[model samples]
Target: MPFKASGRATDYRAIDRFDGGAGWIAHPEETMQRASHVLRASGGEADGGAWVVDPVNADGVDDLLAEFGDVRGVVVLMDRHARDAAAVADRHDVPVYVPSFVDPDVDAQTQPLGGTLPDSDYEVVRTVDWPGWDEAALSDGETLVVGDAVGTTEYFRAGGERVGVHPLLRVKPPRALRQFRPERILTGHGEGVLTDATRALQDALDGARRNAPEVWLNGLKALV
Candidate 1:
């Protein structure tokens, strides 16, 4: 099977619903040339049921929903990653949560995320807070979900060599997303870092701060 831009084959696997009624599902395939993931965190009696974060449009969504529960809401972590959020939201009849900087493009239920996640246990930390651009990290205590703010694709290409941060933000130099200090990180453009996630994030932040030549070159490659 052909892999997505992350250079990894599709990995749509069943989410493990925890005893607390919270779990997650990953959309194996990439649409619009990017990897995507979803978090199934329940809100409460007020909310219909479980909610999703940064969902990608794929065939497995319906099946996952059926297996899990109702998807009451969707969250988009970055402006550039709103590709399939609307479709997924509409399919499940849920609202789409996004930062004010994001443009959903598609016609669906969209609402600006006022510095907080909808109703999930996860909390968002703004990593890229530039004048015109913004990106954040959503953490559910154990797992951290990120957008283009970090990546693992480039590293996968060099035979599992040391992976680095996404190149584009190297120019501005990204701040360390150490607020959450999660053990695992799920990204929107890579296979994800499950081991030493905090250390890996720090290393990537260091590389971005120095504006490493390779990092810049790789960021350029992302454009073409």
Candidate 2:
């Protein structure tokens, strides 16, 4: 894949696949694409215009954007070690959201490199303060994007689904890929276009209301 501009080569790896609600695993057929990332529309026709999440490698933003032809907005999630997502978002005309407290301007140059984020790029305010983690809005179907506020990884697995973070990267549980209970998932580099992901996500939301409240609070705590 083509790079964004010209400069230092950023460290980026591609996993095989990412399936929200189902899980993630390696694509034995294809080799990982570390130099670039990818994204696709999820939710289908009923979704109207929901898109999947994608994490582009260093200088790989252009390749990811090519899929959209031209997009409206992108919710950016910054990982502690991910590349400067804001610049990528800014360059693409999308708005990047950090863990509530992250400064788009300052952080645009601080993130380290190599990691995953809440695939969604929009903000799901649930609170009033900054937290180490937060959600992003990428696809419609009531989808929420998760940033690297929590962790990073190459592949994701759960329930019955399996997908890689990109092309060449493989995620290790507990560390690389932070297993989530999302109804549908959009990786920092790719998006999950599920047909019934909304319902699944809604259930997760309701469940969070019942149990994840404290986790959300923890994020709020981090912001302060």
On TM-score, the leading prediction is: 1
In angstroms, the error of model 2 at 102 is 4.9
Clashing pairs in 1: none
Alpha-carbon deviation at 76 in model 2, angstroms: 2.7
Model 2 lDDT per residue over 72-115, tens place: 33333432323434555566655443444433333443332112
Instruction: Report the lDDT tens digits of candidate 1 across residue range 1-107.
Output: 13333422244544324332322334334322355554555543433456566665554456655544567677788766666678778877878887776654556
With candidate 1 superimposed using the best TM-score fit, by how many Å does residue 20's alpha carbon deviate from the native? 8.8
TM-score of 1: 0.74
Candidate 2 segments whose C-alpha is farther than 4 A from its true place: 1-56, 59-61, 71-74, 78-82, 93-139, 142-144, 148-183, 189-224
The lDDT of model 1 is: 0.60
